[model samples]
Target: MRSLFQTYVHGSISAVLGPFRRYLPAVVLLGLLATALEGIGIGLVIPLLDVVVSGGSDAQGFLPGLLVSFGETVPRETRGLLIGGAILALLSVKNIVVYANGLLQAWIYGQAGHRLRTALARKLTAMDASDLLSEPPSRMLNIISNESWRSADAVAAVMGIMVNATAALILLAFLMAMSWQLTLVVLLGIAAIQFAHERMSQHFAGLSKIITDQNRGLAGRMLHLVAAWRLIRLFGREDFEEDRFAQASDSVRLAALDLQKRQMAVAPITEIAHATLFMAVIFFAWSLGITFGTAAAFIILLYRLQPQVRQIQAGLAALRGWTGSLDEVQWLMTAAPAEPVTSGHLPAPALTRGLAFEQVSFHYAGAAADRPALHDATFEVPAGTSLAIIGRSGSGKSTMAHLLCRLLEPTSGQILVDGTPLSEIDRVDWLAHMAVASQELELFDGSVTDNIRYGAPEADETRVLEAARQADADEFIRSLPQGYDTGVGDRGLSLSAGQRQRIALARALVREPRLLIMDEATNAMDLLSERAALRILEHRRGKGTTLVISHHLSSITRCDRFIRLDRGRIVESGTTMDFNEEQLARMLRTTGT
Candidate 1:
């Protein structure tokens, strides 16, 4: 019991509830006031028993004797009425304080939940893009959105334990004053019962872990349903998915049912124990030749003390049940990448003179050192010029593009902006002046205008329309059911892949960034649309530099200069005129570009 209390109260709950710790003093004061009022009411019970049951003659013991002496100071005729009214008044005040304390605890619970969710979001944003990508999206979302609430409930359980223990201890003091010998026996018996009950709490901790794991699996399955429903339908896996989901759900239901069974059993078992203790107290009183009024008052106090003791046991069980989730919450808040993302204090990068890759190379974690994803390759793109990268799938074309965009860093070499290393620039400040449209397009659930404006929030309607026209998206967008106001479904799946590509391009162009990168951005567009998009690229020359990665021969031929990668190494570089259509086709065949 002592170990569990110390681990949760002083350990698990401490960091989880740190933000709300300062408010505990006020909670303690309100709890103390409520307990004091309850103790006072329990003290008055003996005087009431004397007036109503013993005809004001049978009062005994220290508390009853004190009340008896006070009763003597009052007129005997009205004493009974005064004592009963005072009891009701003290109870009413105690209930009021208890209500306020409940509200305070609720506020703490809400704030704790809110802060945890927001902090998780901030932590994810602060992480390196590669580190964030390594996390399972479904499990991360479940922890932030669902498990956080369960953890916050643990904080409420801790507060409940504290308040209930305070009331229980103060009521025990009342019992001790009335009859120390009986109080000793009662305390010892209750201690044994709690000791046995601690074993049940140990079981709850295990059950809580089962429930947490099962719920995480269930959440992952549900997310798969939302994200891949189309694929499920296309593959005709409806029945299979249903069976898998049912199994996951049943695991959660069974584990949760077992946990609830133990928790609900707590109150009833404590009730039976208290009833037995009640009978034992009466037998002890009779053996000692105790009066009816004094014994009656003691029983009344013990009955009132029953719920406080019951709450203490139940609260501890609940804390054990939720502390499993609380541990997860704490882990999420403190978990960090093996190495922090390298951030520099330099100002945003400037692409004034040119950009250079000085023997840049990269490989993903855990891959063979010799089989690097991108081998040592060097290139340069001067300001106000365009560079094209052409390679077949798995040639590390995308890796090189990501490096230039600062989404991933090269393993051994440096990428320089003008004369500065890319890592030295402020990431966020530099990204504001850059725009990228890639094959993995992400369109939010909103209108075409909203998606386009996402690239430049301050873009006016004229600029939005111009960018759309440049990407050859304006005609199709205007033909939609609601024109610019049409809502795209999740991930913009409601639109064709080609339509989404153009919208993504429009989004990139709306920003008028100093640097633009397009990786397989036109693969989904028809031949005419692809050519028109390239024409738009040609029109914007000299304003800034453009980097294009495509398997299309036309896209390669249109650029000012091009680099060809094969097996993660740059194999060739030259101007567009260096290769005729036949030579480009022969080169593409030999290099698998």
Candidate 2:
């Protein structure tokens, strides 16, 4: 429990002070000034009560001593009015300062939130591709959108704790000056209640961890349901999914209830402790022959003190609740020490010569050591030449593509681009010269033109139309109600599978890359449409390099060269013309296509 509190408090401070360190001193100063003003206002209550009791008699105690020294020539009536005016003035100044402090804190909070979110995003972008692939998308989404915001809320809670704690301390100082004996008794009683509350509240941190896990689980399940809605309905598993979701939600509900119960107990326990202390203090003062007016003033001060103490306790509880989120944000921001994708200082040159893989071998992390994904695979594609890699599933076709794209580094051998080591070229520049379209299509909720222009945003309208025509999507796009302006629903659900693929193809083509990669990009299209797509590739045959990863036999016949992979090894390599009808049939049969 002590560790939990320390973690939360440290995280909250690091998040707030680390991002907004420059303005923190100013914010602290404002808080102190506001707290001082509040203390002065509370202190004036005793003098007002004294004036009322003695019918505007001369001021008493330390205040009177100061006022008499400061205003000997001032009249008594004027002095009383001045004191009343000073109290009002002090309260009015405190209100203004409080409002200003709120504005500054808000500014700091907004700045810190923006900084943290931006830094998280940048860190994710800079992370290694392998690390990113190992993580679940739902977890990343939850941390970026949900946990990051909660971290910002934690900052606000910390600031509240500071403000309230300061106010309580200043008020306590005023109370002690008024009557030391009574103030000491009240302090002791409040301390005892706070200690008990802390003991009971220890469970909140664990409960919060449970709620965080449940929320992430629920979010993952919800995403699965939405993405696989058709399958769920086809299998008639609606009730099953509902039950799973309900179970997750119920866990969250129970955890929240337990935390709330512990938190809600603080108020009543503190109130009881305060009321009993007030009664005991009154009896003790009466026994000591304290005056009624003094007793009444002290009671008013104690009443004001209770709320500040409560605010302090509530702020502490809120901070504890946010500990889990802070931990998540910290995890998201920290990157593991792994091999990164881009680490070169030299700019990537144009692929004028060719790309070559020299005895390349790669094994995924945690994969069977003996069964590597790609083993001793060696190939070369000369510039302005096309190469088709045909293999059955689990034969390392996709792994080769990933290696070519620099998404995965080769474990044993080097990949050279134009005779330069691939790792020595800047990744961003290398990627800018290449484009890929895979079996998985990623289309945002936008218009046809927006999706096509995603890769080459500055492409002119003429270029976009040409790219669409090249992908055989222009006619279908024109048939829509708004043509290029028509909106595609989320994930392009409003479009057919072929339409989405064509749009993705168009996105790749619009970049006019030096190397174009198509990994089963036309599987959804019909035979005629697939033939038409291949015709477009035929036009770009000698103009630039192309890598076609497909099981379809017809898709590879036009390539300049072909390679057959089986069990992570290259089984054969030659031009399509070199293979006889029998050999081609056997290759197709071996690949099951």
Candidate 3:
């Protein structure tokens, strides 16, 4: 919904000319010169037509008169060869320029495609989390992978309409100069044919939008199928997924067929209409007793003019078919708006005193107005200490963590570090001091060392091994065939749930962050492993700040204090001895389940 549409729609010719703008004047000049050369080549043919029609009488036409007065008193005997040679020369130059223009246009559009892809990628990375999440991931992927390229070609189609229109106009002017009477009749008929096609163009554009939407949906289905491949087999529902994919694909094919049928209808109908007009001009010339030389020249010009008109009409229809692509590229390139969230320029202060969320409240974009995911959520984790947040599923625990991580900004209130609004701190500087290991692991498809060193790419092997040892993963990792260099496979699927979580924890530890966040980080581990992981967390007690978000009481046994959330509200806050183990267990039994 957010886009550069207003700016792009006003310009028909961008790969909707964003990066190609600087070369516009040169490109336009070359295009115009090529078109002019083509027109001149066309005019040179007029004299040849006159020679054939009159069997060597003095040619009498505006163009033939030019050669007659072509900067010389020409001998009549050599006029035909002279005009013939001129025609060849003009055509050769015109074709050469046309070829070069084709190369330039191709490069311009290629650059546009490259720019569009890179720009969309940059925008996707740069957008605020909420703005990025506003649209479906599959749809975004569809635009970036497929639609951007199509949009570039769509821009070329739009340019085709422009250049073809110009050619038609120039040829029209030449027709009028030859004989306005005949030109008038021809113009009206051509106008009527194109007028009828105007409605077809609108329909084509409508179908284009539908196909674009359908492709986005299909992309979602494909991505889901790939992502859920194991799940589908485990559930024994491969047939169901196949049928679902088939239906979506069939729908896309039918829509495209309908569009192609409508598009193919343009050519024959225009040709038939113009063919009738072509003959009508011929018969009318006989009736008017126009001079033979002039009529031949007129017919020749009209013949050349016909294809240009056809190109304009056809390009118009095809351009309409690509309207969706242009719109999508425009959206992807500028979808984040001017400034979705306010950010500040100040450097992040060291976490000396504490980090506090004061009366923080946030809801998703389309959630209920009255009910927020986290409301009036006030809490603090002092420096050199750990705090535990216990909450049931959907109790806004992860939302709180996301806010803390600056993934999402609060709808109101402020998260301050050392009493400075966290929003005012440089985000990159803040992130460098923080790391998170959560229930949802994000292990990349790479070696164990690679995943551990992901954010800290320059981290050496000693740091990676030490981090893995801290997370209790070094032993199992060394047992694998490639040890630290073993490929994790897609999302680390080759590893067990516990193994992946340990790797994720190692990733967090490898950074040695100032504030470490562990959100259900030990859930996948066994009894011994979970206790060991909890013991490992205990080591950060006084050297750094730590926040543990968990439903299990054992996971936060070493925390300095605790906060409990029922739904979005912080229902309780206290030190460790405030609640008995039995009472804490009873309270958290249903938290994550």
Candidate 4:
């Protein structure tokens, strides 16, 4: 009981005072005035009812008892006018107070929602790339959109209940003074009903947790399936996808239905207990010989108290789910980034020298020992040179690129640029000098110019158009109905694979970085387009550093040097023409291009 009291008080204080800190003094003053008027309204009802039932003039019985209790005496006629006028004044004041509270609550709710969303968005934007990839977009959206709103609603509901509960308790105290025995009976009945409700609340929390987990899973799956619709269609696996989605959706529905059943049972059980108590209170009141006015007020107090009791229980149950979700969100927010931490700026580009990797080794966490991805790899590329990593599908080519870019740090040994450690460099400033185009293309829903300008937002029109021309994307983009202003659909679904790749390449080219990394960048392009892109890359061989990860021998031939990896170890490294007959045959068999 003490724990619950503390939680209730803390929640109320946080909601009413903390969120509205600047307006606390004014809100409190208004609330106090409102609560006082509400008490007066409740007090006035007793005299008004008394006059109707007792055949009194000007509600003669109204002010006398209260005035006498306060050690005052007055004539009946004067008392009647004073009490009547007091009741009217309280009613008017109560309405105004209610209006003020509504205004204050609205303002507080708006500010609280804005603050929470801003904090959430800020946290999300600062999170590392690995963290962003591990969680689905819809789950993040659910937390930001639905869960935050739920928290706001819960806070508002609980605060309103607490305020109203205070008022109810004060009115109950007045009724108790009129007849202690009747008050005891009513209180006992309410306590018993509340005990039952507490039991219901405990049971409901278990169900609520199950329902929440299932709902999140369903949302995540639906978002994934929708995003992968094209792959599903190309593979002719619509039925399989539908069944997978149906299974997830059905689990969510069943869990929700079960929780609803449990919740629905609570109302009837509470109502039965409350009804039995109300009857017992009436029986006891009559036996104790309470007056008509006191009886009327006591019954009215029960009528008000019953709903409040149920609400307190239901709100507690609802809050359990909310708290559980908040804890999950906090866990996500506090999770560590996937990559290793480094404190300083990234090393300067090799420029006039070379980049070197000495005894590099890395294996993904939790992978089987026998299936380690990369082990003891050693390689180097000279200044103004392009290196193409060539190997079979399971080879460590892409892993090397990730290591070079510091997306993932080596498990052992060092990677150096111009003899400076890669770990010593700052992430943002280092990444600014590099452009990476991975196999998967991400085209945001925006204009062609916007997408091209993504790499260098401040790049002028001449720079953007030059990049597009170099990427061989200028002709296609200009052919669009709106040219550079055309909107790309979600995830670039509106564009063909070749078109999307060209646009992405254009974005990277616009940056004119010190190092350019391409992983299967030409896989989507036709033979002619791939040759055209290679011609463009060759033109800039001495201008900047370039690293290509490809299985295609033709692409590797375009680079100044070729490096081959076998089980993560660099087995061969030389100019393309120096490749042994065996290496050339292996490459031809692997890629068949």
Q: Which stretches of candidate 2 lie over 4 Å from their true place?
A: 1-5, 10-13, 55-82, 287-290, 336-342, 345-349, 362-376, 390-396, 557-593
What TM value does model 4 have? 0.84
- Write one digit per residue (lDDT tens) for candidate 2, span 1-593: 35754855755458545857677677667777876776666565555555544644343345333433444344556756776787789989988998998998898888888888888888787666667766777777777878888888888777777777777777677667666777788888888878976777777777777777777887788788888898999999999998998987788788778778888887787777778877888887787665554566567767877887877777777777766777778787776534554447677767889889899998877678898889998889998888888888888998888887888888899888899998888877888889998767579999999999997999999999999998889999999999999998899999888889988999999999888999898888777668867886788777788898877777877778899998899999988889865677689788764
Q: Which candidate should be chosen as best, given TM-score against the real structure?
A: 3
Model 4 misplacement above 4 A:
1-33, 51-64, 67-85, 133-138, 168-187, 337-341, 345-350, 359-377, 390-412, 562-575, 580-582, 588-593
- lDDT by residue (344-403, candidate 1, tens digit) is 568765677888888888987666888777888888888878888888788888888777
For residues 267-357, write the lDDT of model 4, one tens digit per residue.
Answer: 8888888888888878887887655655665676567667766676666656653553544445444556545467355556545677888
What is the full ranking by TM-score, best candidate first?
A: 3, 2, 1, 4
Sort by lDDT, top down from the best: 1, 2, 3, 4
Clashing pairs in 1: none
Clashing pairs in 4: 344-425, 344-426, 345-425, 345-426, 346-425, 346-426
lDDT on C-alpha atoms for all candidate structures: 0.81, 0.78, 0.78, 0.70
Show how many residue pairs clash in every candidate, following the order shown. Answer: 0, 0, 1, 6
- Cα-lDDT of candidate 3: 0.78
Model 2 is weakest, by summed lDDT over 10 consecutive residues, at 63-72
The candidate, 3 or 4, that scores higher on TM-score is 3
RMSD of 2: 3.5
Query: What lDDT does candidate 1 reach at residue 592?
Result: 73
